[model samples]
Target: MRRLTKFSSAVVGLTVLAAAGTAVAAADQGDDWPYAHHSAASYTLAAVGDIACEPDDAENAATPASLKCGSPTLGGMSAEFATAKQATAMHPDAVALLGDEQYQVGKLTDFEKSFEQAWGGLKMLERPAPGNHEYYPYAKKGDNEAGQNGAGYFGYFNGHDQAGTPETQGQAGDDTADKQGWYSYNLGNWHVISLNAECKSDAFEHDCSTTDSGLLGQETRWLSHDLAANRRQCTIAYWHQATFSATTASTATVPASAPGAGGAEGAATDAWWKLLYQHHATLILNGHEHAYARLRPMNPAGQYDPAHGIPEFIVGSGGEALDTLAGSPGNYDNPNVVTAQAGAFGVMKLTLRSHSYSWDYKPALPGPGFDSTALKYSDSGSGTCN
Candidate 1:
């Protein structure tokens, strides 16, 4: 596995210092911080994938019905990223793991391995949303291990709740301090929300279709009440999985829009989106796609709706093997779709300016594995709905 070198650490440290300086420079220029400023500065948050310390060998196991990366065995494809050490080196203010941070099974031991690796370099900064794997019931018959998917995840992350701090950009209430794992925070001018996908699995057989599932019950109530109460200038929701994807790789893999009603799984999130729109949301970021994609502002139905659309981003390529794009490409086919890139691992960087923000998808360094070019996507000179 690739490890972080002292030199790289120094480089990142220097870059972070430089960014701080730039923020200062902008303040000196006019206090209209661009890119690195406090009021108008940008902070980075990355969404990553089905990270596994032990990848299952397909020859010996049946492939997961929904996961497309094939069976993950011990250690992932990237040797350099053996641990979350690489993520720490990048020095993002915060980091997000989409789901399947472990593998096909959700054992506490397996979670420890995956967590140790994923949180290696980023122990202090890692904030996660539980995936379906984490919620896999521990008592299922015939399953290798009867594990409650998120027990370990919540055990570790729930205690590190810092959502109320100014760094996260929210006023975490008593509920946040108590719930911990499923909380919201504010950093700079953004309200960041971390959700547990396992919440959607509270239904029978741990399916999204389950009404009254704990996942839906808790998050929906929280989201509804929270959105109704938030007064932030910009809201950014980050989670471990995607509620909607234009790709047709696996329907089972796609998250349901609604919690239990299930009219349109993705549509279930409309209430939250409407609340965000009412409060002026800026973006929604997620992982679990094992690839990178950006969607134009659109409604839950994937229809173009500039007046109410919220920009959605799937940045699941962080240090994992990228999944191939599954659907027809280009604007003609998916009008609400903007861009999709497969076959590369990357980090997404957003630079927030006084009037707008610019985002960049920095592919991994060119090698036999993934591409290494920096592709920039901007949503500047545009106004977010309020």
Candidate 2:
């Protein structure tokens, strides 16, 4: 196990003094901001997963039944559109897209048509992770998307320069300059990381925890090193699957298209959670379960502790479709879960401070205000970094 340093605390004290300089540097790195003029004292971020609409007819007529398709309501426009609208309304400095940005086999065509239509506006500000759908194999030969290797994902975010064909660019995750989705950046005094979690072949029990599979395993090694070298007081890690799941959704650890729906069985992410917890990571965000669930502070071992623990949030209600919230909040099988709710599509907004963070999550309903029917899944609170 590892521990955070005192020097990180010292740095947080002076974050405001250097916010102006850091913000300018971050923007120059090619990340987008709504406008040039904004406060440097604190930054707001919007994070959600299982986004965009699924691709139904985007495929050919002869596509095999093995490749699933569905008729989304209004082409999944209304649900995803609402979330994107809410995200932009908050005017976040950056939007952390946990994963599953595209659905029903993450084809580039689907991304352009369904995802791009709704959340494409946030592409300039999105820091994304690859989900199982992104790695799903092509339904047929010679299709536009490269079969299941996340070429489309990398191509969209990292750019298509000479680094490597834009599609295959960051799929390697070797910690090189071009490692694509698994990269880190600074937000004021906080250091945030986006990790890739798809491991093993697409038809077996996921080897998500095997840190020796070479390609995806290399990413975890890089994460360990990245944490050891960090000097920031606050840190947040985001990925597609939740390590500690909390609802009735499927959390199978198998290598299927929708493994670990609620994330209860997602031991693949546990390896990374160990590292994050050891370093006293402030927060962990994930998608996959199509509901919003917040867990009580707990250690990597799933034991609760207020003094030294990391809180996890499952904000998968980013659109697509809604999964059931299972039984209830405290009644769930997972002991750490405090709240879980569904039937609403929305985004979680975070106002990241120097050493603390305040989060406000609200999902939009059809007509007026937010969703408050079955459960008041919406939440607002503050927490300090460990």
Candidate 3:
């Protein structure tokens, strides 16, 4: 497991330096500032996923017109760039990327040409989770071709060295023999876990069974240990596909048996949900549905459990074309969904405190057929950890 590096430590160091400077300036004025010695009690985190269209997708004439590159533009910039701009403007202490950050095979070239050009500025501040796209090598969904084994995704994050093999560069543990990409870290007072959800990929020989021998099983075991060791008051986990979907459009296009058949991935994650529920996890964030939806807190059984349930936020509206919500406006197929919107690209800003957290969803650009009203669409709320 890769550990949190000097980047996060540098952020803390800078905060201390800033505080020292403020104290010196205050002392020169001969005024005792009560808040001088106290550092900020909360930190801001910006999150989003399902970002960046392939630069060559348009020329290749990909299906579902929305998949074409250079589309859903705003003010002469692509939607991905717009949302990146929005997140950058917030200057959050850290960025939690849910998944599907690079689309259509997630090759290194594609990431460099598309994702890097847009979201690269946040690289140092980002804690990323892998998506199906990062594992699969095919452009179309449900392809049986050999996958990238997370070579591109891990190479990009772990720092690609031309001389080293992908496994040596930490390619989601495909060839690492032991460690997978799942890891945990602390952000302020909150514990953050980034899990690998592409267990069904060919990289692991398609072993996602519930037993301890399967790849996902190993991940679950690690999660159990991680949670047991964690002492933070608030904890959050993020990955690619959600166990509870907020959009029906994803399942509408493919057969239920397909590799990434929307709900199928969700079903496969039941074990994860169960583990998190037992651990009293505060939140789950995911992407893959290409829309944004905030679900009410619920237990692993999908029943509303306000007292001990964990709420989930599906913030897939990073840049790719938005998916249709589960139902008509103001109504939803999933009763647990509190609010959802599909005609905008945006990011979720999370203010994490000691034992509580607040969220603000800001739409940075309009999707196809959406007017200026899309920019006005907003959702904000606060919740306490269990």
> Which candidate should be chosen as best, given lDDT against the real structure?
3
Q: Rank the candidates by TM-score, best first.
A: 3, 2, 1
Extract clashing residue pairs from model 3.
none
**Candidate 2 global CA lDDT score:** 0.66
Q: What is the lDDT of residue 125 in candidate 3?
A: 62
lDDT value, candidate 3, whole model: 0.71
lDDT of 2 at 7: 12
Could you estimate the TM-score for every candidate? 0.66, 0.79, 0.82
Could you give candidate 3's per-residue lDDT for residues 219-318 as a string of tens digits?
A: 7888888899888778898888887777876656543223234555666677888888888898899898788888777778777777787888889999
The clash number for model 1 is: 33
| Reference-based lDDT, each prediction | 0.48, 0.66, 0.71
**Regions of model 1 farther than 4 Å from truth:** 1-40, 53-86, 137-145, 159-180, 199-215, 251-271, 331-333, 352-355, 365-386
Report how far off residue 288 is in candidate 1 (Å): 2.2
Cα lDDT tens digits for candidate 1, 156-229: 44332443121222111122322424666655555667665444344323333213544455566777677677
Better of 1 and 3 by TM-score: 3
